[model samples]
Target: MMPGRNLRKPAPPAAPAEREVAVECALQLRRIGDKWDLRQRILNFLAKLFFPET
Candidate 1:
């Protein structure tokens, strides 16, 4: 392995339920005019959901 490279295994695929939730969130965000604030909020929410222990 190359030095400083991440050796951890790749993350598992997202569950169907998680995909559905992501799609719903995307649709909701699309309806809003401005997405500057919503973008970060969405990322934080998804990160929390996918990495609850972190």
Candidate 2:
């Protein structure tokens, strides 16, 4: 091996490209909807099923 010489040189930097912008539409959702609590309840049920004693 050469003294203090790097085996692999660094790669060349990439050129910048034009980026696309997307327009998003928003909708108002209620906090008390049934879908909000669904994820937590599913996770709890899975944990209970997998680890009962814990």
Candidate 3:
């Protein structure tokens, strides 16, 4: 069986004064199935290996 993928919908940029509300909206998305469980260290290693910014 194939792995189940979670799709995240992108939200439009919020007004400059509504930063807290924008973050709350993103957290709500994580409570749904839009968040992944990958470890940060792994992602950091992969980024250093594949994306060395000169």
Candidate 4:
């Protein structure tokens, strides 16, 4: 093996259940209507769903 090479396998991607939980959390944040920045929160949620890595 080359020096400094990572021998262990990479971690598995996030499961569907985990992703669903994240989405639900985002939706809940969006649903809190009393917050002053509700529109930005909703947009952030949408952005997370569509661009998770970024």
Best candidate, TM-score: 1
TM-score for candidate 3, please give it.
0.31
lDDT of 1 by residue, 1-54 (tens): 898898899989999999999999988887673576688789999999999999
What lDDT does candidate 2 reach at residue 39?
78
| Better candidate by TM-score, 1 or 2 | 1
Q: Judged by lDDT against the true structure, how good is candidate 2?
A: 0.61
lDDT tens digits, residue span 1-54, model 2: 989997998877544431111111112233444566887899899999999998
Index of the highest-lDDT prediction: 1
Which residue pairs in candidate 4 collide? Answer: none
| Whole-model Cα lDDT of every candidate shown, in order | 0.88, 0.61, 0.74, 0.87
Residue 28 of model 1 has an lDDT of 86
lDDT of 2 at 12: 75
How much does candidate 4 score in TM-score?
0.38
Runs in model 4 lying further than 4 Å from the true structure: 1-12, 33-54
- The pairs that clash in candidate 3 are none
- Write model 4 residue lDDT over 1-54, tens digit each, in one string: 999887998889889999999999898877775474877888899999999999
lDDT of 3 at 32: 62
Report the lDDT tens digits of candidate 3 across residue range 1-54.
357977778899878769988888888888664334346567788999999992
Q: What's the CA error at residue 26 for candidate 4, in Å?
A: 0.3
